[model samples]
Structure formats: structure tokens, C-alpha cells
Target chain A: MFSITGLLTISGILFVAGAAALITRRNAVAALMGVELMLNAANLNFVAGWRYFWPERLDAHVAVLLVITVAAAEAAVGLAIILNLYRKFGTVDLEQIRLMRG
Target chain B: MTHAQLTALLPVILLAGTAVALLLVQAITRSHRVTAGVTLAGLAAALVAVTRALPQGATPVTALLTIDRFALLYTGLLALIGIGLTLLSFLYLAGRTRLTGAYYILFTLALAGGAVLASSAHFAAFFLGLEMISVSLFALAAYRRDDPAGIEAGMKYLVLAGVATAVLLFGAALLYARYGTMAFAALGTAIAPGAGDPLTLAGIALVVAGIGFKLTLAPFHLWAPDVYEGAPAPVTGFIATISKAAVFALLLRLFTQVHLREHPALFAIFATLAIASIFAGNLLGLRQMNLKRVLAYSSVANMGYLLIAFLAGGPAGAIAATFYLTAYLPALLGIFTLLTALSGRERDADAIADYAGLAWRRPVLAAAFTVLLLSLAGIPLTGGFIGKFYVALTGVSAALAGSPAFWALVGALVVGSVIGLYYYLRIVLAFFQRTPAGEEPAAITRRVPDAAAIVLTLSTLAVLWLGVLPGNTLTLISLLVEEWFR
Candidate 1:
């Protein structure tokens, strides 16, 4: 079996990179891709924790399944919103759509 | 999974069934009114079920979910808010949209998710409930897909809220890594005072950050004003009242169940967040001309006030927070209902100028708005006043019990409330201003539906009743808190 600490280290990097991309990316779709990465990282952590720590308890493994389902759902909604935004503003760049602001 | 579990989950089952029934009804008839009626009936039935189950008191439905007096009370409150939102959505969508049936389905789904959130006993349930709420809210925020602002708001909420959930899940994984369990009841035994493990501390901090984003406490509050401004008025009201209140309920449960108060560092972290949110919310609100943005900032400040009660970390703090939420809800619901009544077919009447001279044309609406605004500003004879009073009292008692930070937090609360009064009164003042020259009188010809009117009137009366005589509610909340902790 592979080392759990190595898996955790890689997962942590993915989480940080995804968070950075989410914050810095201007394209709505790209930002959403970042969100997906972060979610996957969390799922990896859950699976890793379940395998190395609580092998008998299936809750964390079940949590991975739930996270995947939720991520898919969230991504669908995010893409739909982005399409709507593009239809209205002719672009998915978040900075340009500034209709409602203080 | 068993008879007892089935009974305990009846309210959630009722809500889920209603959502599915709504979808089936939409497939056949597609009548918005009928769909809304069915949804309201479902919520009412669930509320009745919760009330009936209240005497059962703190029944663990499964490892994931618990039904306690606290959960039952919040479930009841959530149902009432659901009914109010359904009525407001009915009015907001009538004759303007054909897909209103879908809105009710999503509404019921969101409410059911919130109920689960209030009763969640494990991290798995917590994440599922939270995701259900966020997913539905993403759709609701952009319901008016034609509106660029709404779509943008939805996109932003989707991205940011997704990130926050990831952080929260990672934190849960960390805790599971260290303790080998994700259940709160078991967590207390796993974590001891002054253990000071770095991994555990990091996990807790990430979890707090995740929750803070949802609550829109300052620094994490940048998306709130824009999202609030961009969303439909009724949905904004839902975010302000139902979602925030339920999340606060969950946070309280988690904090107490895990004995987070035993960690002095965590207390310091919460104190810093409370102070920053109060100052930032008040300071940001002072300059906003848009009504929704102003309310958004004020909500942040109010959350700060709630944190003070949360920091007290005992029966007194729990009672104060519950009482404050009890008072805050009706006023928020009343104001947003009035906004829905004033909205035109194309856009909401959100500009301050739209409210100017409102008293001259819609006197009753104006008066109701005045009571709601005054209540929000924490003026005497309003629910906000009593809510603020109890929060301050809780802080003072905490100081007496030897936490100096509570004293400072109370000082900030007072200062923040005074700043808050200026903006709330500005809207109240706009209502009395004369209509500008060469402009038609500020008479909105839109018909206020009977349901909307009833909601406004009831909420107005509740604000006044709770403000003037809060003793009964306070006693009841204290009794529940005592029972909950025991």
C-alpha cells in the first residue's frame, strides 16, 4: 500500500492551488474548474483518512461519495449561471458584469 | 431505519415528499398558485409534526441526525419562514414568469435542507445539509436569469461557497484523521482542554472560516452586498433570516457539543472576528445608497452582535442568541415583504429615492416599514432593542465571570448599534420626504396580494409584541436551552 502522508501532502497542494486559482481567475468557467479541483482534493483527503485511520468505519468513504455528488450538482448550477451571464453580458469575465454595485 | 427513526424523520420526509409532489404537479398542471399552496400546506404539516414531537425532547434519530427541543423550535421557525417566503415568491413571480412552479420546488428543497442542518449531529449530515441549501440557493439567486446582476451574483456565490465547503470538508477530514470519528458527541471526549495539537487546531480554524463565510462575517463579507443587491428581494430576505439563523443554530450546537469554549485560543479567535465584523459592517453601511446593500451590511453587524452571545457559551448565551433571532426574524420578513409589494415587473424598487414620499401615497406600508426599520436600528419599543439588551447583558455577565474580552465586545456592540441607527433612520427619513417637483406622486399601482399583506401585518405585530413584552419568549428560550444542554 502507498503511504498516506504522501497522499495527504499532494492533496494539500491541490487544495492550495485550487483556492489560489479560484481567487485569481477572472473567467467564470475557469474559476468553477478551480472549485472542482478543491472539492476533489477534499474528497481525496476523506478517502485517505478513512483508509489509514478508521478502516472499519465507512462514514468518511461515504462522505467522499456525497462530496462527488454535490460537486457535480454545484458545477451544473455554476455553469448554467455562467451561460446566463454570458448571454446577458456577452462575456463570462466577472469584472465586466457590474450592474448592481455600491 | 427503524420505527423510532422514521418517526423522528417525519418532518424532513414530509418536506421532501412535498418537493417531489410539487414537481409532479408541475409536470401535469404547471399552476404556480397550486404549487405554492401545496408547498405551504406541506410546511405547515411538518411544523405541526415538529410541535407534536417537541415533548419527545432530544431524541437521536440516527448517528447523523438528532431531534431535540432546540432543533424542533428551529424547525418550527424555519417552516414559518418558508410559508412567508412562499407567499412573497407567489407575489413576486405572478404574471411575470411562467416557471414559478420550479421556484416553489426549490424553495421546499432549501427549507428541508435547512431543517436537516438544524438537526445535524455528524459532519456527513452537516455537509450534505449545507450543500443542499447552497445548491438550491444558487438557483434561487439567479431565478431572474434575464437579469445580468442576478446571474453574476449567482456565479459568485456558487464559486465562493464551493470553496468554503471544500475548506470545511478538509477540516472534517483532519478531525477524523486525528480522532477517528466525525460525530460531535464523540468529539468532546476526543478533544481535551490544553491539548494544543497543531493539526486539531488547524482543523477547527478551517471549520470556523468555512462557517464564517456562510454567515458573511467581515473580511469574508465582501461578496454579501453584491449578492444581496443582485438577488430577488424575497430570496435576499430568505438568506438574511432563515439561512443565517439555521446556520447559527448549527454552530452553537457544534461549539457546545465539542466544548470549543474550553480552548482559550478559539475564544480569542471568535472575539477578534466579532469585533472586526461589527466595525466593518457598520462602517461599510454608512455610505451605501442601495437599500439591499445597506441591509446586507447591517446583517453583518447583527451577526457580530449574535457572536457576542455565542461567545458567552452557556445557557444564558444560548437563550440570548435564540431570543435575538426570534426578534430579528419578523422585522426582516416585514421589510422584505414590503419591498416585494413595491417591486415593478422589470426591477425592484430598491433605490432610496423610490421610497421617498412613500408615506404620502402608501401610508400603511410606510408605517409598517417604519416599525421594521426602527426595530432593525434597535430603537426602544422594538424587538431589536430587547434583542440588543439581552446580548449586552450576556456580555456583561461573561465579563463578570472573568472574560475581559466580553467587556470589550460589549463596548463595540454599543458603538456599532449607534452607528447602525444612522443608516436605518435614513431609510425611515426617506419615507417622509416630499415627492420631487415635476415627478408623478410616488404611488405604486401594484396590487399587494392578501397573503403578502397578512404576512406584513403579522410580522409587524410580532415585532411590536416581542419588543414590548419579551419576557415570555425569553423564559421559554431559557427553558429550552437548559433542556438542550442537559
Candidate 2:
């Protein structure tokens, strides 16, 4: 049997690693990848919670599905914006776009 | 869904269906005017739906949504704002681009999302509504695709908001795991007072962080000024008024449902956020030369003010919070409308110099700007004054045997308003100043669109009317809160 502790530990690691990449990366797409990783980690947590505690309710399962769909839509928007950024500035590095500094 | 549920969801259906039809129509007719007309009609229809439903009283629409007085009030207000925005967009952005149709479409979608968001009582509905609004905003913020600043703002908002949502979802998952339900009422019953469960506490903290990011509370508000400055003026108005208002309304409902005031630790967190936002918002805004950035910081401070009443944690606090929001919306929208009108062909009229000699050039606009800014600064004879007075009164009333935290919040509110006044008057002073020698008067003074002017006039009346006599609206809000909390 897959222990809840193991799944929880894995999600915890996934979350921290994703957050680290999100903060440390300079590329917008890479940062978005970090976001996706974090979302997936949350999805794993949702499934674990569903399996261990609330198997009778479909809420967590449905929530995980919705999260996946939303993440895809979010990625689509993120990539499109990044594409627009590259078209405007000829680079996708977050540090390079400095037009709005106070 | 039952027929009753369908009837209850009529407003959302009207908005969503009209948006899709409008998008399809754009393929055939390339007229921005036609698109704008459809958008306004859609919003008006949705408003009618809300009115029809209001008399029926609170009705649960499906498991996710609730059609209640609170939701009806917020939805109606946002729809009015939506119609005003459509008018402003048509007047301000027409002929600037051939592809202006998407702006209306996205605007409608965002409005629908806000309506759904304001009505949601379950986590599923909440998350879905939030993502819908956020995704559309990502596109709308960058709608002027040719502008680099627009794209940068879009990217920043997308990334940060995504992180915040992930945190919020994780918190929800933890809570669901512990409590066995995702409904707010169910969670309220599941958790006992002073339970002190570590997992529940952690989950609540994470959820607060996520909501704080959306509210742009201090220490998590760095992205707000930049995004506000970069976004098109109309979109900035939507973000400032409708989007933030819906989220705050939802937070009020969610927090009160859980009886969050029973926990002192959470109270400390709210106090810290409120204090920091007020101080940081005022102090940082003092140095801003760009008018949009100044308003952005002022909005941060205003959110802090809203939190003070919210922290009072009683019927009085709820009434004050709704009243303050109702008062603040028109003032914010009026300023943005004027900014939209004054923006020239090349750039937005956001700099302090943009308003120099404005009173001499455009007397009515300058007058409107003066009234709005005065309201923002909480000057007497303005709606903001009444809002602030009520907030402080709620706090002081709490001070009678309540914790010292309440008194401290009121002190910060007073000090913050004083600091805020200096910056607001600086703008007012610029408006009436004489035109400098050899300075060219911008042509924006001559070509104020009829629609924009109408919006300005309406909002001006709302500001003055609410400021002078707030009794009717205050009583309505009090009654609404009474029924709403039940």
C-alpha cells in the first residue's frame, strides 16, 4: 500500500522545489513552468487527501481535474504573453523588461 | 439544474451568452460602436435579471452559487461599472485600433466572472470564478499588444497571481483533507472554537496570504503600482474597482461565515496587514509623480481602511465596510474616466504636469477631479469622510472593553488620512495653477467625448449625493447586512 506519509513528503518537496525555481529563474517561461510544477504538487496533495480521507465525496477529484484544466489555460495565456514580450523586446528575460520602473 | 436554479442563474447566463454572441458578431461587423452597444445592452440585461431575482430573496443556485442580497448588490454595482467602462472604452479607444472588439468581449467575460465570484459559497465555485477573472485580466491588461509595458504588466500579474492561486488551492486541499467538506458553512460546523488544530491554522494562514496578494495588502503589494501604471486607463479602473471589490466582498462573507474573529492569532495577522498597508501606502505614495501610481498606492491604503471595519467583526463593521466600498467606487471611477478623456493620441495623461492649468483649460473636468481627489483624501463634505468616520466609529465602539488592537487601528487610520491629504492636495494645486509661459495646451481639452462626459457627470452626482446625504444608502446597506448575515 502507498503510504500517505510518502505522498505528502513528495508533494512537500515538489512544492518547495517549484517555489525555489519560480523565485530564482529569470526567464518568464521557466517561471511559468515552476508555477505548473507547484500546481501539480497541489494536485497530488488533493488526490492524496481524497484517497485517504474523503473517498466518498467527489469534490477533491473534481477539484483536481479543474485545476489541471485551469493550469493549461493559464499556461496558454502565460506563453502568449511571453511571446508578445519577446516580439516587443527581442528577449524573454524578466530582468530586461524595465520600461515601468519608478 | 432545476428550473428554479436556472432562474436564479439568469444574470450569469445573460452575461455569458451575450459575450459569446458579441464575439461571433464581431466576425461579421467590424464596428467598435456596434460591439460597445451590444456590451452595454448585455450589462443592462444582467442588471434587470438581478432586479427580478432580488425580490425572490436568497436562493441557492446549485451547490456552488447562492443568489442572495449581498451577491445581488455587488453584482448590480459591478454591472453598472461595466456599462460605464464600455462607454468609456468606446469613446476613448475607438479608431485607435481595428481590433477593439476583443476588449468588449473580455470585459464582458470579466464582468460575468466577477458576478459569479461575488455569489460563490463553495471552494469549487470560488476557484473557478477567480481563475476566469484572472485569465481574462491577463489578456485585458496586455490588450494593447503593441505596447511593451502592457505585455510586461500582463506577464507579472500572470506569474504572481498564479503563485498565489496555487498557495490558495494547497490551503484548500489541506482544509478539505482535515474537515471533509469544502463548503464554508460545513467548515464552520466542523471546526470547534479554540480547537487549535495545527493543520487548520496553517491552512488558514496560507489562504490569508493568497487573499492578501489579491487585496494588494502590504509586503505583497509590490506588483500593484507597476501594473496599474502600465495597464490601459479603463482596464486599470476595472481592476481597481470591480475586481478588488468582488474579492473583498467574498472575503467578508467567507471570514464572517467562519467566525474568524474568535481567533486572536488571526486577528493579529489582520492587524499587522492593516497597519503596514496604511503606513506603507501613504509613505510610499508621497514621492510618486505619476498620477496613476499615486492612485495605485492610495488604493492600497483604502484597502487597509476597509480592513479596519472588517476587523471590528460585528454587524457594525460589516455595514461600515459595505458603505465605504459603495462610497469609494464612484470616486475612483470618476478619476479614471477623466484620465481617459484627457489622454492624448501619444500617451495617457498621468503625469502631474498633465494637469497643470487644467482648471483654466477644462473647468468642468478640473472641478470633477477636485471633488474626486477630495473624496479620496477623506475631506469633509465628501463621501470618503462619512466612510472614514463610520470606520473609526466602529473601531472606537469596539474599544469599549474590546482589545487595544481596535484603538491602534483607528489611530493608524487617522494618521494615514493626514499623510494622504498632502499628496492629494498637491494634485489639486496643479489643476488650478496658471499655465506656464510657452507651454502648449494639449488638444485633449477640446475633444471630450459625449459618453465620457456623461459618465463623469453621473459619477460626480453620485459622489456629491452620497457625501451630502448618505442616509438612504446607509439604511439599505444596514438592512442588507442584517438579512445577509442570516
Q: Pick the candidate with the highest DockQ.
A: 2
Per-residue lDDT of candidate 2, residues A24-102 (tens digit) = 9999888999999888888888898889988898888889999999999999988999999999999999888878977
Tens digits of lDDT, candidate 1, B1-486: 776666668888898899999989988898777888899899999988887777676788878999888887888888988889889998988867787887888888888889999999999988988887888888999998777777877877887688779889888888888788889889878898856887688788888988998899987898999889988999888888888988899999899887756898888888989999999999999999888999999999999999999999889889989999999999999989988888887888777777888777678888889999999889989898999999999999999988887889999999999999999989888888877555633334456788889999999999999999988888888877788667
Q: Which candidate is the best by lDDT?
A: 1
TM-score, predicted candidate 2 vs. hidden true structure? 0.97
Model 1 local distance difference test score: 0.86
For all candidates, what are the clash counts?
0, 0
Clashing pairs in 2: none
**iRMSD for every model:** 1.3, 0.9
What does DockQ come to for candidate 1?
Answer: 0.74
After superposition, the stretches of candidate 2 with alpha carbons farther than 4 Å from their true spots are B441-446
What is the CAPRI rating of model 2's predicted complex? Answer: high
User: Residue-wise lDDT of candidate 2 within B211-288, one digit each (tens)?
Assistant: 888888998889899989988888888889988998888888788877777877788899999999999999999989
